[model samples]
Target chain A: MFELQAPLIARREVASGMWVLSFSAPEVAATARAGQFVNLLLRPGPLLRRPFSVYRATSGVVEVLLKPVGAGTAGLAALALGESVSLLGPLGSGFQLDQAAGSVALVSGGLGVAPMPLAARAAAALGLQVHWVHGARTAAELCSEWEGRRVHWATDDGSIGYHGSVLAAIPEGIGQVVACGPNRMLAALAARFPRAQVAIETYMGCGTGVCLGCAVPRTSGVYDRACKEGPVYQANDIRWDVLPQHLHYGLGA
Target chain B: MSGLRVGGVELRSPVLAASGTFGYGTEVPLCDRPRLGGMVSKGIFLQPRPGTPPPRIVETPSGMLNAIGLQGPGVEALIRDYCPLWAEWDFPVLVNINGESVDEYAELAARLDGVPGVSGLEINISCPNVREGGMFFGKDPAQAAAVTAAVRRSTRLPVWVKLTPAVSDLAEVARACESAGADALCAINTLVGMSFDLGTGRPRLAFGTGGLSGPAIRPIAVHLAHQAAQSVAIPVIGIGGIGGAEDALEFLYAGCQAVQIGTATFIDPNAIGKTMEALEALDWRRLVEGTRAAISSG
Candidate 1:
């Protein structure tokens, strides 16, 4: 993992408070995979670095999606075009997609959409058809910026494409499920599809396992660092009953 | 000239990675290796610990609270897995040993004794998150001395007692450890603190309370390190909220011979290296003498 100041190349508010920020981090972008994340050091804001999923990486630039639910995300959302922030990443394990045969479903909920676009692109490059299923509380909160093929939108208020949760909108024949979202949704996904890969959410520190702060409990009664051992894990391996649902983002109210 | 000795272990720089913050000294590769004086591995017990549950950490203004409860692999695993890696590294690696009893502390020291790549032991007697034995011995001078003395008798390696700022008389505990044959003293573990989640009407940390670290605790760390330095002849390795060279100087000016970088690493993985780089620009002898003069004058 490399730690360096990457200049902000682009910033866009894809949704009301949701932002897609791109930085000129060639090293991290070069090595960044589908589920890996970048830890942005938000100085003049919070004391700890906030982890963001790699929304997309192209050429020499890396992008991360942010929903301004807290002071740290708000500060990152307010960064001007020319500003540079300290970026430490390409950290944590990413989605393992090489083994899938026919098709792959990239599922996301709310800000969980951050990593879906990248996962979609990666699966497409592997000659596999990709299905992107996204959901938000309302259509206003939906970030449908992805240009991937077969994008399906789900909303809780019956104001969008599928008038139900993202899980309800998944195509019956969709293959190899990969998801990133809140604990409850992931837990449900784990129940239905035990082999699904999930990117979890946890309050993190150090983003490197050193702090042991981001403990994601396993079904074996063992805890793993969400930053190091994961951010990505097979759904069935997690002990969902013990997971706390305190975070605001991902499949909002 | 930047190299120095702390409790008999030769540190290339005066900045060491504090225990718990640096893990087993195996996780962070971005940390500048050449600039690191040494590293104190995470605190370990006799057996593997599951540590506290989720929401173990919460960020506060200018600091963060964590109650990881000294989660770590047991000593046997450390000697087998981590020590070999340390033996290959170019710096000293001190194991931060914890115990639920004085005998347990002594046994941990004995287990690490003569182990390859193990330079010394930092007795963790001030972990507030644990239910027993951690800060229990640290708060009292007699118990502090007793644990220190037992560990001293168990191992031939240098022993540094990490002090807790939660105590009423930090100096008394420092003197007691020195009298019990501590090779050095590491002043100021995290200060006990808690934060509440207004929505849930409950504490932010699952452990209810945690040890606060980062810039929020720097001033208190300098003060306590100074008090410990004044009370004991043994070296004082300053810790808590040391983010940059200026902060490390506060500890040195307060009479600390060296400093350890903790919570700052979370903000910047290269904090220790950056601090070491900044310190390299200063006169090392003057800094040491400055600390000595500061302690002697008071």
Candidate 2:
């Protein structure tokens, strides 16, 4: 892990309220894995650092996809080109692929798609056939697409491929699954696919396992910090029933 | 730039990472550990605590509110799991011990007294004295003194009593701890405060209220440190909203021998290291002389 000031290289509004921000952070980009994240400082106010999953990492740059839901994220979205942001990463546990599985399904919902593209690329590099299942509230919110792949889509309204949810769009014969989305959606995926490794999100303090603020209760009765023990965990390891119900996603309604 | 002598222990730097914020001092691999003077581990209780529920933290205008409820793996687990690693570090590792009663406090101190990895103990008297009906020990001078005395008797290690700003007369509490045998004093734990979420028609944090820390509380902390330093002879280690060398300088000018970087670690995990670097670049003799000159002129 490294803490460095990353200069903004590019920014793109991928969806209605979502943005894909690229930064020049060679050290972080060099060490970051598929599911690891970076914690960015929101300055001038709100002393707490906000955590963003690595959307993509290339030669000497890292990208983070975020939706401006609160003041911290809004500050990030408002950053101009060439501006610098303090980044602490590549942090937390990333996705662990099963080498034995010939194929895998990558699932995401809303801004959860932040980590999917990289995960897909990583899984594809391992010679595993990758299937993408992504969903959002609407088409405008769909946010991303992978070129030259068998991609599936779901939306709350009938304007998308699947009329209901992404959970229903998971095709059969996939030996492994990796998902990131709302707690409810992740829980449903866990219930349907016991082998799913789902990325969990929670409010964090230190993001280094010190504060114990972002603890997610596990099936064995021990609390695991999403920032430390995992931002990713196997389906059976989590106790979804006890997980907090309401989360402030920060996307303005 | 130079080390500080706090009671029997000698810290390599004057900037110690405050408890709760620094974790066990081993979690952040990215941080440069040797740059820190020392680090106080998270609060350790007699029994394990699950801490508060989700939304345990909320951002304020210039700081943040957090009611982590002292979540920890209990003293036994800490000693068993982390002591060996701490023992190997170049810097000191002070355990911040918390309890509900004086006896419990003494027991924890006694247990850590001769432990190889442990350097000292910071008695967290800000916790409620449950036997006395939820009154914070730090809020009552008499109770604070009694707890300090008991812990002092139980351990040979240097004891630093952590004070809370919620009390009316912080000087009296500092004096009480000193008289009862505290080696040093940590002025100002997080000030008890709360924030409301107007949109949800409810409190922002799940625990309703939390300890407020960061730049917003710096002035208040400085005032309290000044008062506590004036009222006691023991070394005062200042804490609360200390983000950089400038902030640490305020406490030092107020008579604090050392300062702990707390909330700033949330903003920059390498805050303590950076503050130490900043302090190294400063002319301390001039800063101190200037402050003294201003005081004398006034």
Candidate 3:
């Protein structure tokens, strides 16, 4: 992992309060992969670095999607253009795209969509059919700008796309499924598709293995560091029932 | 340019990574190992520990609270898996030994005593998050000295006792450790703290309370380190919320021979090296004399 000061090369308000920030971190962007994350150091209070999934990376520029949920994130949203921030990343294990046989399904719920665009691109590069499935509470909350080949949308309020929770809308018979969402959503998805790869969420400090803060218990009763052993792990390997079912990201599950 | 010796162990610089912040010294790459005096490994016990549950850390104002419960792979794993790597590093690596009893502390020191990579021992008598042993041995002068003396008798390596700020009399404990054969003292571990999640009506950390460290605790650390230094002749190594050169200078000015970077490493992995780069330009003799004058005048 590399740590460097990257300027705010680009920023956009994607949805109501959600934003997409792009930084000029060549070394970090050069090695970033799907499901991997970057820890951005914030200004002023809340001394710890905030961890965000690598949303996209192109031409020495890396992007991260975030909603101002806490002090650290809100500080990030107030930064001016060209302002530099410390970035440590391309950290943790990424999604296993090569493990797929033929087709790959990228499933995301709400802010869980943060890592799917990159996962979709990585799967496409490997010559696998990429099927993107996204869900949100309503049409206004949906991120429809995914540049994937085929996209499916699910909304709880039925304002657009498939009705009901995203879990009910997922189709069976997909070869390999990679998912990121609230722990409650991922827990249910894990039960349905026991073979799916999931990104678990927990409060983190250091964003490296040393702190041992973002630990998630495994089925074997051993706790694994989410920032090191994985932000991505095989679904069935996680002891989902034991995880506290709370929305870590601001967005709903 | 500025190098010093702490408790007889010669160091290349005065900036060391605090225990629990830098792991077994294996995870940090060579490129990040900038001009560091040394690094203290994470606290280890007699057996492997599972640590606390999830949500173990939470960000407060200018600091963070953590209750990691001293999760580690035990003393044997340290000698087998980590020591070989430490022996090859450019800087000295002190093992931060933790124990539930004085005998346990002595056994840990004995096990690491002549190990190739192990340069010294930093007895962790002050850990607030654990259920037993930890801060218990640190809060009382007799207990703290007892642990220090036990470890001192078991090994030939330099022994540095880490003090907890939770104690009512920080100087009493400092002098007791020095009298008990401690070569040096690391003053001011994290202050005990707690924060609640209003949404869930529950404590943010799974362990209810955790040790608070970061910029918020820097001033307290400086005061405590200064007080400890005044009470004893052994070199004082200051720690608590040290993030930059300014923070390290405060410790140095308060009579600390060296300072350890803790939570700051989480923000920038190169914090230790960066602080060292700034410290390289200082006149060490003047700094120490200035500390003596300031302390005497106060």
Candidate 4:
């Protein structure tokens, strides 16, 4: 395991507060696993490493989604194509895709919808029937739409699809559910589903396996480091309430 | 505060930011760089280290843990990409060099030979050194001394040795680094700590049991810094549990020549800047209080 600072090989403002940062790392891309994350060692001068999900992985590049919410993201968003930055990755454990998730419902909030496009693509390749749900505080926050999948969007203000949350919109018949988002949002969904797969967030350090810093309580009675044990976790496995009183990414609201 | 010389350069303050936490100085916002006594950069190895598996970091209350595994482009890559940047900056940039072997250490030191932007060297003996039977050279005085001696022989740059607190006798290692012609010392690297997931009942880290950091490890850092400072003649740069200026002062009172902010940067990049501001405020308060007392007595 290692941590690296990759430069911005290409970046473009895709939306109001969001941009696509393409960093340099070949080994990371070659071994890129679905649902894995890399701690983008951004403006440590301005801020420390910021974790970003590997949105999509190619043979030589890993695409990460960035929302210019803070100093690090803001600096990252301003990078011109080919401007170098540091990226230490591909860090953390990722999703354990179950071809057994025959009929599944995937849920996320705003940019958290990241790991999905590839996940849906992966499940489709596995021939698993999939249904997807996306959430945002507003319609302006939503990113891409899955082409052939049944996509649902929920906005807190009712700007998009559902009025409440994905948990409320969750159709009752699905056997397995997968999700990612704010701790509260994830917490609510975990509280609701209580048996779905989930992902958690935290500020990061080494992005490798040496720092036992992140924590995720498991339902079966265990605390796991979100960095190493998961960015992806089985929903039923987490001890939902043990999350930090103040979660990362200013997502608590 | 006076004898702040390490190797060849003299520093104004005994505190220096530790490597891996502060990138080559420039990584910090420019406004705060001036207050830092010095900056030890992310670990530079012989070859670029494409660090370990993902989820490299996890934040805990008052601190953060990281398993960056000393990720950086090789020293050459650093010189090509990061050094010139460091040269232009006003704050001193001390490069922390890491390797799996003694020769690698010496070789890299030699390669760094005349790089202009580079200031001094931090021997990251916290890692394994070759010719030491795969044992972490930092854990043993003999290996530590041998590795220090080798690197000392290789470079004229200010060489400061970084020690890990996980070892049994830190004093022995301190003395070893001193004997090996080291200039100054960075005390207490990350303490070996880990957590596990009880659900799957598996190890938490893919590498299992990563380093524990942040406020949780502060007291231990202070204890080690004091002990190392007492044991060595060289200046001590204390790192660990340093989330703020008071924590940095705690190290200073314990006798550290300089201090580093590690996990603090994860949560607040301005930790060093804030701490410096806090210290100055305290300094101003002390100055005023002392003046008032003198005037009253007179």
Best by lDDT: 1
Q: Write the per-residue lDDT of candidate 1 for residues B225-291, one digit (tens) a residue.
A: 9999889899999998999998998898888878999998887888999998988787656876866
Overlapping backbone residue pairs in candidate 1 total: 0
Task: Tell me candidate 3's interface RMSD.
Answer: 4.6
Once fitted onto the true fold, the runs of candidate 4 whose alpha carbons sit more than 4 angstroms away are A1-253, B1-7, B12-14, B60-62, B127-135, B284-298
Interface RMSD of 1: 4.7
Candidate 2 docking band = medium
TM-score of 4: 0.58
Summarize candidate 1's per-residue lDDT along A77-160 as a digit string, tens digits: 888887989999998999988545588888889999988888888898888888889999999899959746688899999788
For model 3, the stretches where C-alpha displacement exceeds 4 angstroms are A247-253, B30-34, B290-298
Supply the global lDDT for candidate 1. 0.88
Which 10-residue span in candidate 1 chain B carries the lowest summed lDDT? Answer: B283-292
> TM-scores, in order shown?
0.97, 0.95, 0.96, 0.58
Q: Write the per-residue lDDT of candidate 2 for residues B135-249, one digit (tens) a residue.
A: 3788899999999999999999989989998898998999999999999999888877777766686877777888888888999999999999999988999998998999999
Cα lDDT computed for each candidate against the true fold: 0.88, 0.84, 0.87, 0.69
Give fnat for candidate 3. 0.60
What is the CAPRI rating of model 4's predicted complex? incorrect
Error of 3 at B202 (Å): 0.6
lDDT (C-alpha) at residue B91 in model 1: 90
Q: Is the docking of candidate 1 incorrect, acceptable, medium or high quality?
A: medium
